[model samples]
Target chain A: MSSPVTTKPFETTGPGKQVLEITDLKVSFPGLFKTVQAVRSIDLNIGVGEIHGLVGESGSGKSITAMSCLGLLPDSAVVEGSVKVTGHEINGTPEKQLARLRGGGAAMIFQNPMKALNPFFSVGQQMFDVIRCHRDLSKNEIRAEAEKALQAVQLPDPHLALKKYPHQMSGGQLQRVVIAMALACRPRLLIADEPTTALDVTVQAQIITLLRALARDHDLAILFITHDLGVVASLCDRVSVMYAGEVVESGSVGDLFANPSHPYTRKLMSTVPKLGLGEQSLDFIPGQVPDMSSPPAGCAFNPRCDMATDACLQPANKVLVVSKDTDVSGKHWAACHHVTGKKPSSETALSETLEEHNA
Target chain B: MSHLDQPADLLVVNKLHKTFTTKNGVMTAIDNLSFDVKAGETVALVGESGCGKSTVATCLLGLQSSDSGEIVVEGRNLLADSKAQGKSLGRDLGIVFQNPYASLNPKMKIKAIIAEPLKTAFRLRGVELQQRIIELLAHVGLGEEHMDRYPHEFSGGQRQRIAIARALAMESKLLILDEPTAALDVSVQAQVLQLLKQLQSENGLSYLFISHDLATVEFLAQRVLVMYLGRIVEAGTVAQVFKSPRHPYTRTLLDSVPSIDPARRDELKTLGGEIPSPLNRPVGCHFAPRCPRASDRCHKDVPQEITEQGHRFSCHHPINAAEE
Candidate 1:
């Protein structure tokens, strides 16, 4: 690890600009025995006011990708390639510079609101602390700013909320306060990792609506990370499906849903039990996520993918799944040798074998 | 009341009530809750947190005795001599908790965890006990290789499978699955749900599936009960309830779930206000405070249980068929 002091300070270019840009970003954590490849080579970009969903199962490196953008990875992590936030490189940025960049250049909210907040302190004190870290303001001015931020997230009676402690409020309200704290820094980009997973459905809906509104109104780019396909479908403008540290599919939400080319993505989409679908047998990808320390040589999802062939033994390049003639921006792409641009057939030998094994 | 009146009903709860005395005052966790699960039937109890779902599970498991209720399991009243009938009750009911990581003993191997229930409940030992553990593991999609590994070695999905295996160790007629799939990923959840469905069919297992995930309930359960503030707001077949939810709370819950269909993205209507504190519930209908179509009568008088065919809902102003 090297630390270099630079005279230059980090600054954002302003709203209506590209918020985040990643090029061939790879992150690996070095351990005693072996190095865990948490994130393989992947490219992602989020523009101003764009809500990009990073959908993946556990250990697929979705959170790692987001953490890398903010330089939040541990010191053991050897992050290669470029991670630019608001046109400023963050991959090799110093801790001081990264601290300055975070909460203002980019902010993040986690799944559990209680875990994110301090139970002992009042919500007002925490908000003030977050605001003070990012900006130099007086006590009265900071309190006003905190209240304003809370109001922006649509917390009814922001004044009352400020006096209340984390335990005094409900889960939904605590989440709102956390979001407001994140927004108090006036960040251009927001990284929400499974923000609504801990919440109830009704509360999840409210939070989703709040986030969508925040992205649109505040012109904030959001990288929403979750395993729930339904949330991605409803909230995101574009989505990237990850499997075992690699993004298998990336495209507009509509395009990806209509024609999920990647076998893993298709299998994942089919697994979500849809409402009003009646009592039907759910289709599931047979195997669990591959271990990161010693993943498969070529495609990580090949073991579970029904479409896996001998060609999949080698690393697959991102192939354009959409037609060449279409003028759609962010053209549909899948990192699979067998991207047929067709929906997955219902019957497969993989599921059959799984059923037989269970039987 | 005699369970012989309904021999087919595996587990029945008649007017169950459970109250807790908190620091502030007494809290009614469950208020006159009544429902039943037939032999090999999957009856889901869906509700958000603090809705007395867990209390119902505890009461059924005899972990907590209800204030006044008859918990009948296979023509046996569980409330009667629950202390003396502990061993038999354990054989009759097995429970799978939400978090697999916390449920299992981390220090123990998979075999010991599964054997704990079997050895204590059935008093089996030696070759018979080992064989039974293997069979249970096999039933849950795990091979003999995983029998020696500790809980830490297995993944979330695999740990959940082990939990299910232990839950089935007693061959308990009714398995109380309390948010079993909530802690798992979507793909893994699918696998577990499939395993559960397959297990139910193969062994004719009755499941009192308690979950907040409506989609999974719709998939696994034949009958569904929507709970709110410790009361059964609505009950019907999956098709009937999901297709035509009459209660306002049920409608709100169904509407709140985000659809995977991208076209219906804008249809999510968030329910206003949080669940009322159980200690200080509303005067009449518990959901009246947040009900969109709450009438003056709803707040003044408790709604009677209105039954139509097999579907029942306690709502003063139920949504009409046209509204659906």
Candidate 2:
């Protein structure tokens, strides 16, 4: 509690020095019955020392997009995209090279810590194996580095924890161990998928603080995947809101929270209850994410969006139209045919109604 | 602090105590717990993972016997003779667990599942039973078409609605809902909560809502009982407790919740260490180890519940005491 952990202020990364970049990423599972289009064409870029968030409900393709970066999708998946980590292409690489690049180049932490860690091996044994795979260090050197990683995450009794099995540790302690293992190789890019969803509120806060510090001190680029927008606001600098396999909106966290444009983003933000606010029924979006196999034509969110027009039934493409009277960077945009290319001055009626309440 | 002057309503539990002798030693799961639910009110039991909230529910439903308690329902002691001999009290109390997949029987049709309680309790058979099942389905926002569907066929929200319909089959006055919406997504959770509210108003049914989600508790419950370890640490109306939480543990929990607005993000002072093992609990206040304002008195003597302006809290140093 006394450690001096200061998070760097959030600022947009300058162009031309991206640490992780994805372009036109599309993943589909062709089955005998029907084809499940998991992820449509999408793009993303994260600079070094930045924490970028991918947030959506279940079956929103956020997890699959992250999996594509690691080339971990199953063989049945038809992936067509370019995934570059530290300026090296990861997709279409052979299994041997991908295995080598996985830990040393990039690492991923999953949701369930107990299931992620092997039950048979001690924590130290599994951690040493990862270190040995990435670096050629002596036994003493490896143990020292592992202890350092454990201590960096603020776990108590680092040496004793190494001797215990995964089942012997608490949920919070096990998560710290998983984080330590992920950081053992010092991978440049880290993909954490709902790492704190299974933890208690207090433990989640601690882990969030740790992640922020890691991004600052290690200069590591992170792709944080979660369904909770509250955690995204507190942790991420920039965010991408996905709905039914498409990025409906992408912008800085402040801009998105203040003036959300997409109907799904606005409705999703309203679902989260404020802590000090009085008792009020939450406003929830109607219906669920459509079945991936037979998605509707035109916009995927057109069926559920309240602002859908007659033109919304036709196909729409991505665009980066500039909004009026807002501090939105040119990259901050939404994929809606209704809002595209229309300045706020002319479309004041629709913009005013959609302005509503961001919360 | 005294309910002696008021008339008892639907459910009243007094001095409930439960303990287990495990490999570690004697562990007190419920320590002198007491609460009352009116005819049409929602009383929420808020706590973390293992705070004996579920144990209290089980005891009330007669699924598990308490070590010693006086559970009275509608002017009759549920722990006493005659009618209690055959567990007929179950007709008055119904409970829904966290996981619908486990609580529901997968082999049976939705019709048979909802009719199971009615068949055993009232012996309504044949056409009458079928009509009643369909009526229950409609009451919970489902339709007659879902009557033949199995538990696995419906979505999570639809399954929970079916579970609610089953709980209301016997015209039970009090329903115990344990984390009913925890497993569902946020938007779907709102839908279920709205349905619960609608049902409560229509049937005038009382609910003993148990959940760890504070926002849902604030929306649904008229009163809240905050539990730490195995004891009630705070009890008050939603406005009283949520606006100005008195206990240190309650304050910590509220602060730990992440806010969606970055400007409202307070400096988070997370509690160190996990909840102490129930078997090897610390002396005096169970929350003393984690409470930042805990004094030597908190570690030595259990603080008695203090009441002011209908707000009751157990703490050595309650917040906003000077203002009061």
Candidate 3:
């Protein structure tokens, strides 16, 4: 994230505002023989305080997009493209400036707390370090601030929990502690990479609720990266469905669920298990994510899409942005060859949703 | 023999107990856990991350032994065996771990990884060995084309297929899937699970499927075992267990997985406090501490398994809300 500098452009403000804007965001890695492109010419706009879900299977370039925003990629990584957060250009900034941007612009909570946290340090000390690094405060002030953050996440007996090491806390508690650390900085934009995947379903709900409430209370933007459709359905305001290093679909939660445009997105929604839904039934897309070292031309989702046309075999059928309600509604956007007039993955999906709403 | 009176069990876990001695004290990980898995049944050990599910699986596969118990797999006692007899036990007990790439050797060829277990179980070393590897690969939804490729050549789901193939290479009666689908994508999870179901049905192999997710449990398991603090609080057919969950912990866990359709509101029961540390497992009913209906008796007396209508529960107060 270290190139030369540019001048400050504008001040970011207002409700439903764009907190993050990424233009041609590309990240690549130097493989043994050649370079591997992890992300390619991606553009995304995350609305203010709304959870923008980034959904995809592993190696779909979801994590890299988040990491690149904070300049946390490895030595082999070559990041190109612009990542602007809070009206501050990030892609080519100095490491020191990038570090400053990190807890200031957006905070991140990782997938595995056990690995993300230092095992040697206590929960309190880790929180203290993060808090003190971001803010200029006294020792007592830092301790009090950290405890308050912990309490907000509903960690019981914050003082005692603070004294305990990361290893001492349960997986669920450690995750809450991690959440507290992220919230401690009060970042304008939050990037969470599968934080709740390691926790149980009940614990997962608690964490999601904490995140949702925190978003509402603090008026911060969240980019929740996960593969679980059930989670995205309930938590995210808008979702971007990625496949093979490219986002095939992006739309409002209800619009996307009601009418999933991308074949991959449609396939993903069908896989979520529902109550009294069906047995001896499964909606599946054939094939897997292509080897990123050399991805296929045209649509990345074309290989597995059952409704894929020959046009999908071409190079330029990316995402088709659509308005749900009105002109300039900007409510929904989908990346797919076909926008309408085709049966989606499961026949009963829409009706079932309606039935649920009616009941 | 009637179903209730039948003495024959494909996998009989009797008084399985495992304790890890730390500097602080002895932690009772799996406390006198006992269950039975009939032939061709998928018994899901459903719980959060550290509720001794893996411990029980390791014991059954002979990778780890219980402190005091007997694991009878296909009529052979896994824990009772002497050193010489145990070698035969590992052959019949196959395991599929969480990460396929972690279990498999990236350096070795796919054929070699699948054949390594076969060499121990069947001693096949000639052209027969190569043929067996192809057959195993095909069983796991992978083609013969995947034979020459390395572990890194495959996707997460494909790697899992390779691991499943290797597990099946032993031709074992029991296949332990410890979060096999947890590491894969949800869409890919359905495919792998469907393939697993097909293999299990055609081969008549039993699965001791362990996972933290209850949704996956409902999908794959015929019989569900709800574990908490190293104890089985509830165990029954998936319908009997899920439709009428007797244990509060089981119900709470089910409510936790956010429903895909937002309109459906099965009020989630989030257990208020953190799951009590496994290191200091409650002496009586392990769930009593977090249980909403915890009584004085629940804190003092161990809950006995209530065997009624082909169901079993270890809760002191197993309420029948449906009847109400």
Candidate 4:
């Protein structure tokens, strides 16, 4: 069989090296009984004008990581480590400074447009509030900019949209309006969390196309968070997978899909249903994501992993970067011990690990 | 078509039309839709969100009255049948909706939920009723231990299994599965689908599967019906329609799905504009407004359904292999 063609290189370091960087970040909520560790120590980097994907199942700390970046997590969340946007720190920055950075440097669009946009106000009024908060433009200029933003999203009859309420528009139209508001701020980084999950298939295609174009033409750095790996294959350049509050794998989309070393990644890839194919059953990973309050020690995926060993139950290093000679990109990294050259890909490693446990 | 041409034993729908008078105006939900589900075969109704697939399900279950149509179940005309006969005919049809959480009652135990249909259909009671519920639980892969627990105690997959058991209580010949796995996770969805496939083979059941997800439909359905704006655009076997889609709308719908392969990450071929309001549908062909190959002729007159080698499609200009 022919080898699958490797698409675009995941890491596209543009003119500027990096736009957003996080080092050793961790987030936890201090509960009355026990602390809920939402995100473990993790590091990430997004280059200028690049679309980075954060892929994971629900409650996998993907959303919490993005929320930590935007400084939008609840006050009960206690965060550690450094979050830098353009080499400026946001971890311990004052609320006033963070607001300025968020209003100008970073913006976010949520999944539910109806909940994100206020119902009492008109669409135009919401857009105007955001633009006015970031800029000192007058009434007519603000209205003009709002109309331009709406038109940029290709909404039909921009002026009529501004006059209408959120309920009056369709789901696709409401999402376009949300994107229009985010772009109106002229932010360099956009964090969209499951933006198209609630839309129809045709409308989802339209939204994805729009986001891809915006990232290319506007030189915007995007952190596209979603649970669908198929979408990541088509849209994202680099992908990072999180499991149980830790990033278990990170690499370029091409290198990752062609050779997924981590068992969790492999199981996830196998579950994607294909089109134009005959009836067949799908391979599934057993069990569910562990409760984060008291996660297992070594690897969170051990319970569901078919290749788990005794070593997998104990504490280990956070991540181990693995590179194959065939992948000249040399950017592929996996956190699994077996794939990192500590042991071979055969069944021998598990027996060895098991022997060590017995000894 | 003559009586000899139609499949007599299976469920056959002919010239089904349904229109609703909404506050916006009157809207046609199903426009001259016709199809059939063969015995022991699965027929899928594929369409977008508001294309009237749910309306067809409601009309088939006799929950909602249709504007006009003929519904035939096991050679019996459902519309022309008497009220007393309709009550007995309920056992022939069983439906499972998308959300299992809302469908199952929180207060009712699993045994009572499964027995609800058995008791009403046959007035079965005492030891017979208990034995039937146990048999249904076993058929759906549940056990006797699960009979005492409530619906909230089970996981999503297990709850769906209970729902399936309830549907199969009356030994239903035809099951209407309306987006049954949409609310489930991928791994859970796989198990549920596997169970359904096994049940179909064991009981020789016929299924009318309705969903917007093409992937699941490909796995479950033997015959595929592509719907758009209340009309069947294409009808054929899964291999014929998916491998060589003749209708432009069918091609558009299939092209919209993002596959697992990373190689095919090029520009997506999207249809122009949104689905038009049902109240303000175009005059000639419903899809003429969005079709890429629409000529002046397409806008002026409706095209007839063309049948070629058991594959039927309605289109003025079908995309050839070279163009595709």
The lDDT per prediction is 0.85, 0.81, 0.77, 0.81
Candidate 2's C-alpha runs over 4 A off are A1-17, A319-326, A340-359, B1-8, B80-90, B104-171, B321-324
DockQ, cand. 1 = 0.50
Per-residue lDDT of candidate 1, residues A1-359 (tens digit): 01111111112354425688887899999899998999988778787788889999988999999899899998999999998888899988889999999999999999889999999999999999989999999999999999999988888898999999998888888999999999999999999999998888999999998988887777888999999999987798888998888888887777777778888988998899988879587998876677799999898888998988999999986665654333342357788889774322333533343223212
- Give the true-structure RMSD of model 3: 7.4
Candidate 3 lDDT tens digits, A1-359:
01111111112255325678777788889878977888976778775677888999888999999988777888678888888887788877888988988887788989888887899989888999999899999999999999999999999999999999887788889988888898898888999999888788878888877777787777778899998887776677777888777777776665666667666777887776665442546666677667788888788777777777898787543333343432311344455667653333453653343223212
> Which one wins on DockQ?
1
The DockQ score of candidate 3 comes to: 0.45
| Sort by DockQ, top down from the best | 1, 3, 4, 2
Residue pair clashes in candidate 3: A319-A335
What is every candidate's C-alpha DockQ against the true complex, given to 2 decimals? 0.50, 0.40, 0.45, 0.42
Which of the predicted structures, 3 or 4, would earn the higher lDDT when compared with the native?
4
Predicted model with the maximum lDDT: 1
DockQ of model 4 vs. true complex: 0.42
How far residue A152's Cα lies from its native spot in candidate 3, in Å, is 1.6
TM-scores for all candidates? Answer: 0.91, 0.88, 0.89, 0.85
Q: How well is candidate 2 docked (DockQ)?
A: 0.40
State which candidate, 2 or 4, has the greater lDDT.
2
Give candidate 2's whole-model lDDT: 0.81
Docking class of 2: acceptable
Q: Is the docking of candidate 3 incorrect, acceptable, medium or high quality?
A: acceptable
* Candidate 1 segments exceeding 4 Å error: A1-16, A323-330, A341-359, B1-7, B123-135, B141-149, B152-155
Quote the positional error of residue A4 for candidate 3 in Å: 48
